[model samples]
Structure formats: structure tokens, C-alpha cells
Target chain A: MTTYTFEPRLGTDRTALYVEVQQFYARQVRLLDDLRAEEFAATFTADGVFAPSPGLPPAHGREAIAAALRAAHARRFGTEPVRSRHWYNMLRVDPGPDGTLVTHYYTLVMVSRPWDPAPVIAPSSVVEDVLVYEDGELRTRERRITPDHQSF
Target chain B: MTTYTFEPRLGTDRTALYVEVQQFYARQVRLLDDLRAEEFAATFTADGVFAPSPGLPPAHGREAIAAALRAAHARRFGTEPVRSRHWYNMLRVDPGPDGTLVTHYYTLVMVSRPWDPAPVIAPSSVVEDVLVYEDGELRTRERRITPDHQSF
Candidate 1:
């Protein structure tokens, strides 16, 4: 028999903070998936750092982030018509220093072609993020993503 | 240029209720994925109704729900070892009559084998659920799943 272990539910559940974070991601992810690079990058702090994977250099700021996204988007979809959706699950929210919020969640990217019956799953990953309120809106200050196989 | 449209965010954001509902699904989906049929069904009310797909007949109660899950699990995993994960996204929660909570969200099933580099995505689906407090805990009273292709 295969034994399954449950992932730990981290931190105390803060209702207001949780809802606010969810709403933030709801808008942010759509921007990324829709290839709205500038809009997506705007959700980050001016000096935000995005280390998409351990092997790649982190994008340093909003301008770099948008450029990186645009380059990736053109490379992937330039050859064919495809749509991708980002899915998030098992979110953990905790309070950080200086009134910031720390969050961890699993992200799955599903890609589908016009003729495909279903989207194909990309390698699953977990993201660690530090968020702070900037002008009364939550913005990501730092984000580090680790693919499942690379996680300890 | 292909026009991209965003799904509407439904209902007012209710922090306590949203967190409660997410925690409920976090526990519930694990049970289902682990093939703990009895425990999975127990998350539903005794008279819960599960309409898995529009074309399939609904499982009328908890017992039937358990049985259906067991049968499906056996058939799928009997020949080969496979792991499936359920991912939920874009949740919409609303208050219902009589203090019930209604939820709508997208569900994606990703299936992987021991040798596969990454999981394969199954057809995407949307779930509509009505939940109520049972014994001080939230329980699903009705769940209706509709595949994206079948949805209007």
C-alpha cells in the first residue's frame, strides 16, 4: 500500500489577509497568462525580484520583468497558437517582519493548443513570495519559484 | 489579434467564509486523491448530491458517493500505478438562502506516472457547490461538475 503524507497547513488563518491575497493573485495571474506583460509586472514592487527557477537569473525590476515575460511569450507562442492557464493551490499565508505578508503556494501551468483535447501540464512548482502594501495595495517584493523535482 | 476576456469575480469577498471553504477543499481533495473513499465521502452531508458530469447520473447520497469513487479508483489504477492531483482555481463564493454558502471554481486534474517527466492535464472542469455548517464544520450539500467543453 502506498502511504500518502499531507502537506502541512502553515500559519494561523487570517481571514482578511487571506482574502486580500487571493484577490491579488486572481488579477495578477490572469495578467501573466494573458500575456499582458506590463500589467503583470506592475503588480510587483518597483524593485521586485522574480527568480522564476533556481537555474535562471532573477529579473531585477518591473522593466526587466516585463521584458523577460515578453521574450518568453514570443518564443513559446510565436510558432503556434496556444493558450496557457495558471492554477494555484494549497496557499500558506503568514505574517512577516515590517508588517509584510509571506506566502507559499503550488503553481501548475496548463498549456493547450487549439486542436488539443486537454491542456498539457508543465512541471509543477512551488513559489515563495514576500508581499507588502504599497499605496494601500499589495505588491510582491520578492518571488522565488522551485520546481517540484528541485525542492528538498 | 486574439481578444482575451477575463472571468468575472463574483460576490463580495468574505474573509472568514472564504478561508473556511478553502481549508475544507484542501482537506477534501487530499482524501479523494489518496483514495480514502470513506473519509472523502464523509466530508459530504449524508444526503449530499454529487452530479459529476452533466451526462452522468448524480450520486444521491454519501454511501453512493463512496461506492462510485471506489469503483472508479479501482478501474483507473488496476492496471498501472498512477498519481492524480486535483487543482482548483478562480473560486467564487456567495451567500445562499438559509445560511448556506455557494461556490464556483475551476478544477483541473493532472495525472502522472512514475516515468513521466510531468503530469498530463485532464479536461478542465468547473464545479458548483452548496455548502452548509454541519456539526460546526462545513460540509458539501450539493456539488455539480461541468467540463469546460460542455459548459455554455
Candidate 2:
């Protein structure tokens, strides 16, 4: 294996930048867990694309993605949303070649269904995100959620 | 949604250390791809534990893990090893509470079957690793591989 290097934000104290990126992700996941559709849409760029898996077509644009998320959440939890937590770990931030930030992490979603008293942990996945820093904020350009195993 | 923080390494130029940990992981994956069973076993600590998933029992100790890996590889590829590549991306290194190094990354395995001319990408997963620094080298103390989805 060749030496693999991710020299994003090299020669600088990018600790603060990394922290900000981490916070951005944290906020995004929070919005998702809370079912804040509009606010979650604000986290992405105007033309951001969110791909759930390789087999399915991606939702194009932030608006479309938000609608999809809202529909999915509503279908699963109904009007009274159940308590859920999105745990994101192993956050890594790197600079893309085209003046964007690339971040990746693992996400574990835990929720207490209405019928069950105990929390149920859903299947987890690794998210690869391409983010653009605009107006001093990070926005998603493209996000790909890849599951760990083959579904079909 | 509370403000989450990842203060694993604060106010330190941890680039060198991250690079070292990445190298250790790189070496481990390389040995596995090359089918060097004995050498791959040496990358782990004497009492290291390798858990492929939560549903399955873990392979305790480095020797056992290595033997299992070797047996699996032999079964899949037979006596003659075929070409395969394991791509590890988005590597994140953090400091563990007990002075060990914690690492997480996404791995995508691509292999060429004996009858197939092209390589097929296998299911990918996130690997969470606990590593110890011994004799100026990093060794895997525990590794848990969590798949992104359920296979039924």
C-alpha cells in the first residue's frame, strides 16, 4: 500500500476549522433527529445532492432532499415523533481539490419506538460528504450514505 | 439536541502521530491483501481482540484472529491467492481515555474472483480500533468492525 495522505489545511492550526466542521455535522444530525425539515434543508447548498445508497437514485437539490427526509420521518414516526438520537463518530475533515471540504464519519441511529420501552439501534452507515464553506458556514454539496453490507 | 464535542486531541500538533497511526493501519491492510497471514497477526498486540460484528462471537487474541483470517482467505481463494485490494478512507485518529490511540475508518474491499475478469467491490464497513503504543510501535489492542446494514 502506498503512503496515503490527506493534507487538508496543511501548515496551519486547523483545529478551529475542524471543530467548526464537527459542529456543523452535529447540528445537521440534530436537525435530522429532531425532524426539523426546513432547518435541515438550510444546512445544504442550493443544489446539494443526498444519496442514500448506491442502488437508488439520489435526491437532487436541498429542497427535494428535505422533502424526502420529512416524508420518511413522518411515515416512520407519525405526527408525534418518537425520541431518537443520531450518534456521529470518527469525524475527519479534509479539503477537497476544488475548494471544498470533505468529511466522513459513522452514524448510528437509536430510537425508542412507541410500542417498545427500550431503545432500538438501527443499522448504521458511513457518510461521505462534500461540503462547501460559504459566507463563513459549511454547507453540504453532496452527501453519500454507504451501508456496510450488501442489501440485495 | 445538545452541543456535541470531540475534544480528543486539543492544542497539539498531532499530524505526526496521526500519520504514524495511519501507517500502522496501512500496514495491517496491506498484509491482509497480500495474504501474509503470519505477518498480519504480528500487527496486533498479544491479547488483541477482533470482532467482525455484534451478532458473532469475537476472535480472542492475535493468534486466533490471524488464524481465522488465514482460514477464511484460504477458503475463499483456495491455495492460490488472487488479486484483491482493500481501500481504507477517511481515517480519523483520536486519543483514547487510557492513553491508547483510537482510530476509525471506512474500508471498501475490491477483489477479482478466479472466474471473473473484473474486480467486484465487496461490502464496506467502519472499523473502530483501539491501539497501544509499545516499543515505539502501534499495535492493535481491539478492533470492532461494524457493518453499515443488516444482511438477511
Candidate 3:
């Protein structure tokens, strides 16, 4: 059996920073999953830019982010009661210029309803986020998402 | 909207340890998903105990763990060409007595094939793990998995 070494891109010494970012995502994803648009948007900076994908227009600013999320929620679920979860793994954190953190991770969106026997897993995607400290708290300054299917 | 705070059980001071464990799982889960039973078991201590669920018997020691994993993989996949991914979220890490770390997290097992358009999401589960440092490396000493459906 071949032994695989766990070598992180940013090295093991950045555990504290990595954990901080992970916790940030933990809260951000939950807000989005719960459809708390305002709260979700608050996780980003006032002028944060979210480019969902190459084909879609990016949402700029917290207000636009909140509106886009609410619109997407309404269009997707409508009146149906459903629970959506965003699961992340294989997170990579790197230092960026100007004291920002560049993070990359795979996200799997799971959607299920009370009557459903199993949850539906959306096509996985990789997200690149530029995080910055705003008012002593970490927040997303910019985000770019690339779907797995589209990457190839 | 009511604000939700991200209060971790271990507090923010323990970010370094939390990230260390998260990285550990990143590698451990891949070994299991890829059917590298021996490699997966190596992430545990020599006398690690894994209780998969209440209905199943626990596997004690690395050898037993590896054998159990291999048997389960063969039973589930057989000759089928399927890909399995384990996604984790909502991880909580706490300090345990005797210089051990306790971790709790939710796990979602996703299975898919080359021909399948969407992956199937298994019932989510909560895993409780006790980790200890062996030879300056973190390893799992005990793990207990509780399926979400069985909790109630």
C-alpha cells in the first residue's frame, strides 16, 4: 500500500488561521442555508463581490448579495419547505497580498424536504474566496465559484 | 432577524488544535473513500475502537478496523464501479480529560457512479471522536457514530 503524506499548501504552521477561516465559513454557510439573506450577506464586507459562476453576473455589495440570495431562494424553493445544507471539505488557505487570506474549498450542496427519503446532492464546486478583517472580524471580500462540471 | 453567534465549544483560543484535527480528517476520509483500508486504519491508534453504530459490533485495534472496512467495502460495492465521498460539517472540538481532544461532527456519505447524473446522499450521522497524541502525531483513540435517523 502506498502511503500518502498530508501536505497542506500553506504548511501546517498556519493552523490558527486555517481554523479561523473554517469557523467563518461555518457561520456563513449556515446563514445562507437557513435563508437568512441579510445575516448571510453580513458575513461579507459592505463592498464584497460574489461571482457565482462564469455565466452569471456577479453581485456587488452586501445589499446586492442579500437580494440575489433572496431571489435565488424564492425562485428555487418557492412555497415548498425544504432544507439546504452547504458542506465544505479540503480547505486550502494561503496568504494574499495586502493582508488578505485566499481560501479554496470544495462545496457540496444538499437539498431535502420533509417528505423526501433522501437528500439530493448538487454537482460539487470549488470556491475561491478572498477574506479580510473588517471591524476585527473575518469577512469575505470577494468570492468566485467554479462548478466541477464546468471546470473541465 | 435574530443574530446567530458562532460559539465553538473549545473556544477560539483552540483554533490551532481544531485545524490540526480537520486536516487529519481530510486525509483519513480520503483513505476510506478510496478503499485504502490499511491507510485509513493507520490514522487511528494501535488499539483504537470504532463503534460504527448501536446495532453493529465495535471494531477494536487497527487490524480489526482495517478488516472491517475492507469487508464493508466489498459487501457494499462488490464489482460495481462506484465513487464514494464523505463530507463533514458543523465540527465541534472540545478539550477532554487526560490530555485528549474530543470532537463532534456531522457526516454525509455521498455515493455516485460514472453514469449517474446526481450522487445519492446517505442519512447523515453525528460522530464523536476521542483523539490523543501518539509520537507527537494526533490519532483517534475512539470513535462512535450515531445516525441522525436513529437518534430520535
* Number of the top-ranking candidate, with TM-score as the measure: 3
Candidate 3: tens digits of C-alpha lDDT, residues A1-152: 11122234334557667777777787687688778999989998888998988789999999999999988878888987767777888889987777678899998887766545367777799999988776668888899999999988
Sort the predicted structures by DockQ, highest score first.
Answer: 1, 3, 2
Q: Which runs in model 1 stand beyond 4 Å of their true positions?
A: A1-13, A150-152, B1-13, B20-87, B92-104, B110-120, B125-152
- How high is the CA lDDT of each candidate model? 0.79, 0.71, 0.80
| Model 2: per-residue Cα lDDT over B3-111, one tens digit each | 2222335226465566666677778888988878778878887788888776778888777988888777777678664787886665667777667777776555678
Candidate 2 chain B, run of 10 with poorest lDDT: B1-10
TM-score of each candidate? 0.58, 0.54, 0.60
Q: How close to the true structure is residue A41 of candidate 3, measured as C-alpha lDDT?
A: 90
Candidate order (TM-score) = 3, 1, 2
TM-score of chain B of 1: 0.87
Give the per-residue lDDT of model 2 (tens digit) for A1-152. Answer: 11123244443557656765665664576577567877888888888888977877888877899888887777777876466556677889887766677889887665654444334556788889988866657788789988777444
lDDT of 1: 0.79
Best candidate, lDDT? 3
| Worst ten in a row by lDDT for model 1 chain B | B1-10
In order, what DockQ does each candidate have?
Answer: 0.22, 0.02, 0.20
